[model samples]
Target: MLRYVTVSKNSLHDITLVALIHDIKFNLIKLLQ
Candidate 1:
């Protein structure tokens, strides 16, 4: 159970990081245009 919780938390963190990166890239592209 503890391992599962830890894995889920890690996955959430990674997802959030990816989302943030994607948002930044999108904003940059818009600025360039």
Candidate 2:
């Protein structure tokens, strides 16, 4: 699909990726507590 290709083109932007990873890490830490 075009959307898939487009996202691949930009890799969802560095800022978006950072935020996503950060959110995941936060959730994981929260779970540990």
Candidate 3:
């Protein structure tokens, strides 16, 4: 049960990191344009 909780937390963190990177890339593209 504890292990499952940890795995979920890790996945959530990864999702947020991916979202942040995506936002940064979007902003960079807009700036370039």
TM-score of 1: 0.96
Model 2, TM vs. native: 0.62
Per-residue CA lDDT of model 2 for 1-33, tens digit only, reads 999998776876866989999999999999999
lDDT of 1: 1.00
Off by over 4 Å in 1: none
TM-score of each model, in listed order: 0.96, 0.62, 0.97
Per-candidate local distance difference test: 1.00, 0.89, 1.00
What lDDT does model 2 reach?
Answer: 0.89
**Clashes per candidate, residues 3 or more apart or on different chains:** 0, 0, 0
In what order do the candidates fall by TM-score, top score first?
Answer: 3, 1, 2
lDDT value, residue 14 of candidate 1: 100
State the lDDT of candidate 3 residue by residue for 1-33, as single tens digits.
999999999999999999999999999999999
Give per-residue lDDT, candidate 2, residue 26. 100
Question: Model 2: residues >4 Å from true position, as ranges?
Answer: 1-12
